[model samples]
Structures are given as structure tokens and as C-alpha cells.
Target: MLPLAPSFDTVGWLTRDLATLDRVVRVMLPEGSRAASGAAIPEVLLSVLDPAVVQAFRSAVALLVERGGFDKPDDVELPDVKATYAAFRTVQAAEAWRVHGPWLTEHPGSVSGAVADRFRVAAAVTPDEERRARNVLAEARGALRALLAERTLLLPSAASPAPQASAGGAEVDRVRGATLTLTCLAAVAGAPSLSAPLARVGGAPLGVALVSAPGSDRSLLELAGALVDETAVP
Candidate 1:
């Protein structure tokens, strides 16, 4: 909520169960939401990923259909994953720079060198680059909104299992990059994405996400609750 990038920033919270999440959603969002409604995982999204992460995502989708009473997701074509991620990064960075660059400039070394470096790169985003990225984002938003007009797109919350507290920067960045590729779809589309903490990999928890049309968040949460109840162990 600190305005990482206003274009993609949203206010969300952590909840332990779907019931609690529902309570919060009722207070935060208006009622009377209606339904809006992927059979294929993009290879680009799965390429070079950890086997555990890949399996978790696939299993999550299967669970949604096999148990949650949801229909098999339609196999829809997505725009180029790598290109979409790049454009999202550009717009996010440019907006972030617009928000925080002045403060960062005034306070040298107040933040980590890596954080400062990222802001520096953001500061350097050119007008032409931002414009191109905006165009790409516009197209992607349309494509995704249309795709979700009648169906939800399911996804993994991250591309890798949780890393150790002491994980190196390179390992962290690798996970972050892959995770962003999966998440940036909803961000670029400006859609509502809900994650159900219903999957595990080698006993570690991983969440599966449901992305849907903008006004369909309440219904999406109801679907997520169904997934949780359906998959819960006796």
C-alpha cells in the first residue's frame, strides 16, 4: 500500500481461512456481485521452473475442476509472456520513479544500494519506452478482460517454493522473476485475483490464484471458498 507502483498497487491483507477472508471482503467491498466467468498453462510460464512449483500449479488446476465443481478451463491463447512481463516492468518502474524518485534522490544511501539502483533504473525510463509499454499493456488488458468475460484464469501464486531466510540474492531474484511472470497477467489486466491456500509442495504451502473480471471479486471469493471446502481433508 506504500505505492510501489500506483498502476498496479492495491490494498490487500493476509487471512488464514476463506471464512475470515469473506468477512473482510464484505466489509471492504459492496455486495450483490454477479458471476463472470485455462485448460493450458503457458509453456513460457513453466519454462525453466522448479519441478515442484510446476507440479503444484498443475495439481491446483486439476483440483479446482475435479473437486470444486468448476468447469474445465478453456484453453485460451495468451499474449507473449516475456514481452508482457517486460512491458509491465517498464510501466511499474516508471510510475514508481514518479512516486518515490524525489525522496530517494534527496536521501542518498537511506535505502539499500540495490533499492537505490532499482529507483535509478526507473528514473531513466524514457518517454518512448513508457509509451510502448503502455500500448502493450492496453492490448494485454483487452485480451485478458475478454478472456475472463465468461471464465476464470487459474494460476500459481509463485514460481518457486519459499526460499530460506538466508537465500542468496541471485536465488531470490530468480524466484521473484518467475513469480512475477505468473502474477503480472492480472496486474496488467487490472483484474481481481484471488488466491486459495489449497495446495502444498513437499509439505510446504503454496496458493493457487483465480483471476477474473474487475467487478466479480465477491463471486471469485465464493469460488475460492468452495475450493477450500472441497479440498479440505476430513
Candidate 2:
């Protein structure tokens, strides 16, 4: 049988406000995975506004669960993805400042213009550091684009299938596992475009899950299990 549902406090790491977090989790989770039935609409709205909080919550959960790693079936390399993502984020931030700086100069009262002074400072870095930062940013953008273009799970298609359990229960287990995995992928793929929303809420860009199902506990467990299994091999 599946493990008992994780407590709200335990899952609370998924968001700051209990009500808002609960909504996102509910929408993303499947019926079988819910800890209990309740509406979390308020939590969802608040969460969308603070993407960083949501991201922090997600990262914490991933670390605790040991899923969503680079070596997992998802083929996400945390370090590499993070490095690339950070670089891209830097570039995006700089560009935003660059644009806002001039606009702010022209229209002082506009928020972007008002913030231009800070942007100008960020945009003006030491030559050597700036060059290195630019190079890293370019590389990161390319890497993200490539990842976005891919159609398959991160792991090699040739990786051996997970071993079957003992004979009598093996087929049932396999079918269940496969179904769960597919459901997880679907949910992750269908997640909202968090980039802009995150920026609007957090006043900065943060790494967002490319795929996540808000309320799908089974998917979460399956993903966590896959990451654990893959990481353990060899």
C-alpha cells in the first residue's frame, strides 16, 4: 500500500501560506494522492505571486525526498542546470536593468526608471568580470534552449528498465509503476509558465520547475522514487 499521506506541515514546505499552497498542491495532485479533500484556491493565488517562495519550497522538498536530481530518470543535472540557469538569470536581469535605466532617465516617476540607478550599477561591472559573466550567460542560454528542445526524459533510452519485483505481484506492480510515471511526466509538462509570473511576484527571476503537478502526490512519490533508484545504481 502507498505510504500514509505526508502531513500538511511536512508538505507545507511547498508554500508559505497554508491555504494558497494547498490549492496548488490540490490542482496538481491526483485524487488518489490527496491527503484530504479541500479547496486551496487562496493559497494558489498567493503562491503565483511569490514564485521564489514556491521555488524554495519545491527545492526543499526535492532535497528531502532526493528526487529531481541530474542523475535521475529525468536526466536533470542539478549543478549544471543550476549554473546555466543562474547565468541566464543574470543576463536577463542585466538586460532588464539596461532597458529600464534609459527609460527611467527619461521618465523618472516610472518604476523601471526609478529603479534605473540600481540597474546602471549592476550593468557597470569590471571589464574582465563582465566578459566572463557574459560568456557564461551566453552558454547558459544556449544550454537551456537545447534542454527545452528535447522530447525525451533526461536519461538515456538504453538505460535498463527497472527490475521487476517478485513474480506473483510483478505485473501489477509494473503496470502501476508505468502508469504513475506517465502521469507524473504529463503533470510536469503541463505546469504553468512560471517565469513571468515569478518575476512579477518576486521582483526577480528564480528557477522554476519545468514540470510539476501541484496536487499529484503519487506523481511526486514516483518521481522521488525514480530519482532515488537511479542515483543508487552503480
Candidate 3:
């Protein structure tokens, strides 16, 4: 889950991540279209959400942010988070279609051909749309950072697990696990660490961990469990 506080710097961290995402979109989008200036095309793409792809992306982002501590028990206005997540997926799907659309149409019988055909249609109809999605994704990233800036200090929740005693330090051990996960998330997002110590538990560095897992994989679940466990530990 994304951390909401304790790592207020996550806003800056997200900004850097978005910049990297922009680079990725540039590389994936049509050669010339990527270089074209203005956010017009990208905006249009964001407006049209691909049900499956955008939903998947939103789910993944929500899970990731929630793990990092950005989630609030009370509803938080996170338009940027939702928008960015959707745009990222849309751009990725569009780019995939652009690259493989022709191949799919050529070999309709094959799975690749089928996928390619779908992409081909998507690209053909929404050439500018793909670029627009990328731009929206960038903007969403920026918005998330701004949102995070206002928050500070993340508290543990009932969902978290019990902390374990370790020689290094109880808090340190708990934080170590969270830190490891957060660092991995940062690497994936192309963002820096927005993690900080929240408290001291049995001489351990118990802090709110802000990891970023993109999908609901076993590894991510395990890490989340660890985070919650540490928090719940007495």
C-alpha cells in the first residue's frame, strides 16, 4: 500500500516516477507522435478508458498505494491516483496495439494475430489518443505527489500483524521488511524512497513502510502481511 504520511516526501518521489513514466511512454508511443508537443492527444486518450486494461491498472495502483500507506480509513480524494493509474494502463495497451496491430491482422488464426488486430484497430482509431493517455498519466503522477505533500506520519492499523523481536532492534526488524518492500516499489515506479521512521518498539525502528507493488502477486501479499503483522505486534 502507498504510504499517506510518515514519508511526506513521497510527493517528490512520485514526481520523479512520473517523469520516468513519461520516458517510457515516449519510447512506446508512435515514433513521431511521442515527440509531438501539447497534451491534447493524451487528454483524449484518458477520457476513453479501456474497461479491462484501465480497471486492472486501477486495481493494481490502489493495492500498491494502500500497501505504501497512502490509503486512509476515511475516504481520501485521490482523483489524481485514479486518473494516473488508468492513463498508465491505457497508454501501455495503446502502445502494445500500435506495435503489434499489423501482425495480428495478417495472421488472424494465431493468438498473436488476434491481439495484433485488436491493437491495430485501437491504434488506427486513436493515434492521438495514445499520446493523450501518456500525458494524462504524467499529470496524474504529479497530482499524487501534490496530494501526498499535505500528509505526514502514518499510523499503524488493525490489519497489520504483530511485531517480532530481533537482536538488531524490534522496530528496526519490522521496518527492515517494510523498507525492503518499499525500495522494490520505488525501483518499479522509478521513484525514490519516501519512507521514514514512525516509532521505536523494543529498541526497533518501527516506522510506516511505503512499498509499491503493481499487481496482486503472492510476493506482494506476503510483504503486505509482514507490514501489517509488524504493526500489530505488541
- Per-residue CA lDDT of model 1 for 1-234, tens digit only, reads 388899999877687777788899988997644545323345556666788877877777787688744777656678877789999999999999898888988887888756777788899999999999999999988988887876677777788668889999888878888889999998998888887666788888887878877787788888666666643721
lDDT of 2 by residue, 140-205 (tens): 445433333331222111111233455445554544333333222222222221111111112432
Error of model 2, residue 176, in angstroms:
38
Summing lDDT over every window of 10 consecutive residues in candidate 2, give the lowest-scoring window: 192-201
Give lDDT tens digits, candidate 3, residues 1-234: 433112122333222233353455345433321110100111222234324323333343344355663343222343343455445545655655555556656776666443444455456646677677667755655643443333321222111233455435546544444333223223224332223233333344433433222221223223333334234332
TM-score of each: 0.91, 0.30, 0.33
Error of 2 at 32 (Å): 34
Best by lDDT: 1
By summed lDDT, the worst window of 10 consecutive residues in model 1 runs over 32-41
Higher-ranked by TM-score: 1 or 3: 1
True lDDT of residue 16, candidate 1: 72
Q: Candidate 2: which stretches are off by over 4 Å?
A: 1-75, 78-82, 107-120, 126-130, 145-234
lDDT of 1: 0.79
Instruction: Itemize residue pairs with steric clashes in candidate 1.
Output: 37-150, 37-151
Residue 95 in model 1: lDDT: 96
State candidate 1's TM-score: 0.91
